[model samples]
Target: MNKPCFLLLCLVANGLFPVYAITPGQTEKENPMTINMSINQQTYEISLSDTAAAKAFVEQLPLTLNMEELNGNEKFADLAHSLPTRQSRPGALHAGDLMLYGHQTLVLFYETFQTSYSYTPIGKVIAPEGLKKAVGDKNIAVHFYRD
Candidate 1:
């Protein structure tokens, strides 16, 4: 085993530490960060991905952005600052998939589609059934905050 994990095992075996089993897509933290995405008076809860970029995005939150429309499928806004990135090609994008493009651009997809671009995952909106309608056909004002 790796050194840190072996050390943890030893500590647990000696009754000096408690073990917590983290499930897939979960972190060791007691609580995952959640935020709200408000668009056109409709609110959606966002469960942030466990990533350094996501945490950095949260640090700049309580933000209002005028997101510009693109390709009839997504909205994007350029952030005042850049976040760390671990970019990957997800291949297929889903509605309510929040992502960062090139460390500085924030993107929210409102339609399911295939793509060749790479992006850093941010978070996903829970229950995104009406998301497409809420985002509409043009530029939009989106408010993000923690509560």
Candidate 2:
């Protein structure tokens, strides 16, 4: 092939050609948000985006997670249990409220058995909609409790 034709073919093969590409129904996964939940006085840190982190944190706790219907409108009471002594206040240490840190944004949500709290972090591709749905908004006030 001629030098010009060869160059053109190379450009096309290399995807250097300006082609209008439209990605539909493609939503980027939101950045990982750190949520600190205190159950029985032990602070359990987790990232909703990281399944491994969530699993590891849950495994270390004596509390069994009822993630069966994890979504909005779920209640913490429905999933609460008497954690084993190894995971309780004297055993594992837990924080007071659920602290979420994401993209320079820190959100604290109180746990409740009703409603949902909505959150939108700046520059975050994914919103904590699932969490809001699971935790509910009833105990979502920005108030901190000392145990």
Candidate 3:
């Protein structure tokens, strides 16, 4: 019995044997809807309620959304130049917190219902212009917040 127990301990210590399999509930699971972007060496993580919301946000972005370069760049003129034409729908518009990570910027937009939201990256100089161009001159009632 002593010999058998010693062998088992040795195997476990060397990672040659498993003491027991990890049960599903014992481990933390990854969140599927989290979006992480590194702009200019700074990292930003955005967590959403579900994958659908995340997908919707991504779909609204331009064809090329490269997080790494965005983080490093100082002026977003190039990124802004790449922005797709904005689509308009009937709802209130709310602007969330504007985050600056190095030279990259994040602008969050929320519609009236609050069920959906989207974010876009902008370089310092182009951020305000890009937002104004995206939002247009339409008047829509909306609740707003920023941090």
Residue-by-residue lDDT tens digits, candidate 1, 16-43: 6566777855553456679999999999
lDDT of 2 by residue, 29-125 (tens): 3434444444334344444433332333344344333222123322222222221111112221122232122211233332234323332211111
lDDT of 3 at 72: 18
Q: In angstroms, how far off is 76's CA in candidate 2?
A: 17
Residue ranges of candidate 3 with Cα displaced over 4 Å = 1-32, 51-53, 59-106, 109-147
TM-scores of all models? 0.82, 0.26, 0.23
Looking at model 3, which ten-residue stretch has the lowest summed lDDT? 68-77
Per-residue error for 79 in candidate 2, Å, reads 29
> Using lDDT as the measure, which candidate wins?
1
Order the candidates by TM-score, highest first — what do you get?
A: 1, 2, 3
Off by more than 4 A, model 2:
16-41, 48-110, 116-147
Clashes of each: 0, 17, 3
Each model's lDDT comes to 0.94, 0.33, 0.33
Task: Assess the local accuracy of residue 124 in candidate 1 as a C-alpha lDDT between 0 and 100.
Answer: 94
Model 1 weakest 10-residue run by lDDT? 24-33
